[model samples]
Target: MEIAQNYLDSIRFEFERYKTMGDATFAQLDDSDILWRYNDLDNSISQIVKHLSGNMLSRWTNFLTEDGEKPWRHRDTEFEDPFTTKAAMIAAWEKGWQCLFEALSLVNPDNFDTVIKIRNEDHTLVAAFNRQLAHYAGHVGQIVLMGKMIKGEKWVSLSIPKGQSEAFNTKKFNK
Candidate 1:
């Protein structure tokens, strides 16, 4: 039981950290940057956020009682950029994280072993959480990379600023 609590706490921290990275990346980008794509084959940052939110809403709502793939989810359309403003997309992003965090809070040790389904496939609650963590983290990485590309020399580092790693580690070990 204690282990379950520890794991849940750790997962929440990791998710929040990634969310901060994405937010920081978003702060540096303009409207055009969010919708920019390298080519027709690539998705822009806005499209990635849309896809993430769609997945979050689908997987987290009625998470324990229903299939993760909600019947009403328009998965194909998530690849399209719907918002021209960053604020609108930020709201959507917050809503998605809210759903995920709320659902995660509901899963305690007593329910941690409960089986859930994504597209009719079985997964334990922790397994589902882990799967989403990996998926979301990958998308967040794309968001960061895209922001850096768009901002060019103006981009701020979200973690361990360039050429300072040795100092960072020295401070850490000294503490």
Candidate 2:
């Protein structure tokens, strides 16, 4: 149980970090900037948020009992322009992460070896957790990168500022 609890805690921490990064990024942009896509073929931040939300809800809900891909999930539709406002997009993003954290909290070490199905394939609980973590992290990186591109020089660094690396490293080394 301790293992499961720890795993859940780590997942929560990771999700929270990503959420914070996303919030900071969004705060740097206006509605128009948030909605801007690379071109006609790329997705905007709004679209990515929608997709992440959909994935989180479907995969986290009944995670152990059902497939990661829910029957009601329209995966392709998530890419379309549905979010009309920044508030809506933020709400959807928070909702998805909330679902994921809640579901993860319910897991225990006892279930670590439990087999879960995703897309008809069975995976151990740990494997499933790792898979989702990788998936979410990939998207979070994209979100941060896009946010930086949209904000340009106005973008605030989430981790470290330029020319401050030596200071940051010194602090870390001292610690």
Candidate 3:
């Protein structure tokens, strides 16, 4: 039981970390930057946020009682950018994370092993948490990378800056 509680606590922390990364990336980007893609085949940050939001709403709503892939979810349509403004896109991102956190809050040791379904496939609660964590982390990484590319030399480092890892380690070790 303690293990289950600890796992939930850690998962929440991880999810918040990724969300903070995404938020920092967005802060560095302009409105147009969010819509930029390498090409027609690539997804813009806005589209990615839309997709993530849609997935979260579907998967987390009634998570213990319903399929993660909700019937109303139009997966392909998520790729289309419905948000005309950066604020709208960010709002959707917040909504998605809110749904995820709210659902996670309902989970306890008693239901830690509950079987959840994604697209009619069963997933243990921890498995579902891991799956979403990986997915969100990958997308957040993409957002940060693209923000860096768009900002170029102006990009502020979210972590230890390039070639400064040794300096960071020195500072940490000395503390």
Candidate 4:
């Protein structure tokens, strides 16, 4: 079966939007803020980035040929403070996303029905892709929310700002 180009394009666009959200959120924070944990029970933004990066690389690389939970992936380590600087965290984030995009580019409509495994559970390619997309979006939302809380009023709105819906709609309607 031929995969529609529009479907693949939509997925790619959504993934890129999530990446932009993470980048914008990171931009609003200082290095210390990125590394600051609320308490012993919570993860810092840096830790979240590390975990996201690790997950992207593990799940996307060789996605169809091997299990998503790679044997070499130290998942627990992702929660630890492996990065001391915001720059390091950003680099890891970029690296992981790069791997994910590369893997996604290799997928086509023909493979949409192919079986893939995530931790030994089998799913069709389409199902697996949707599952991971949801997972990444969830994490990206967390990163953005945490950044917003940390930045408070100084935080730049990633989308339409509060109380501006009317103005935004007006502009859209005018267009």
RMSD of each: 1.1, 1.9, 1.0, 1.4
The C-alpha stretches of model 4 lying farther than 4 A from their native spots are: 1-3
lDDT of 1: 0.92
Candidate 2 vs candidate 3, TM-score winner = 3
Q: Which residue window of length 10 is worst by lDDT in model 4?
A: 1-10
Residue 14, model 4: lDDT of 91
TM-score leader = 3
Per-residue lDDT of 1-175 in model 1, one digit per residue for the tens?
9999999999999999999999998889888888988789999899999999999999999999999999999999999756777888888899999999999899898988899999999998888999999999999999999898888899888889889999999999999
Worst-scoring 10-residue span by lDDT in model 2? 104-113
Off by over 4 Å in 2: 1-5, 171-175
On the 0 to 100 scale, the lDDT of residue 143 in model 4 is 89
Please list all clashing residue pairs in model 2, or write none if there are none: none
lDDT of candidate 4 over 6-118, digit per residue (tens): 67788899999999999999888878888777788989888988999999999988997999989999999999865888899999999999998998888887666678889
For each of the candidates, give the backbone clash count: 0, 0, 0, 1
Candidates in descending TM-score order: 3, 1, 4, 2
Q: Each model's TM-score, in the order given?
A: 0.96, 0.90, 0.97, 0.94
Q: Please say which candidate is ahead in lDDT: 3 or 4.
A: 3
lDDT of 2 by residue, 31-93 (tens): 787688888888888898899999999988999889988999999999986587888998998
Candidate 1: worst 10 consecutive residues by lDDT?
Answer: 80-89
What is the TM-score of candidate 2?
A: 0.90
Judged by lDDT relative to the true structure, which candidate is superior, 2 or 3?
Answer: 3
In model 2, what lDDT does residue 170 have?
98
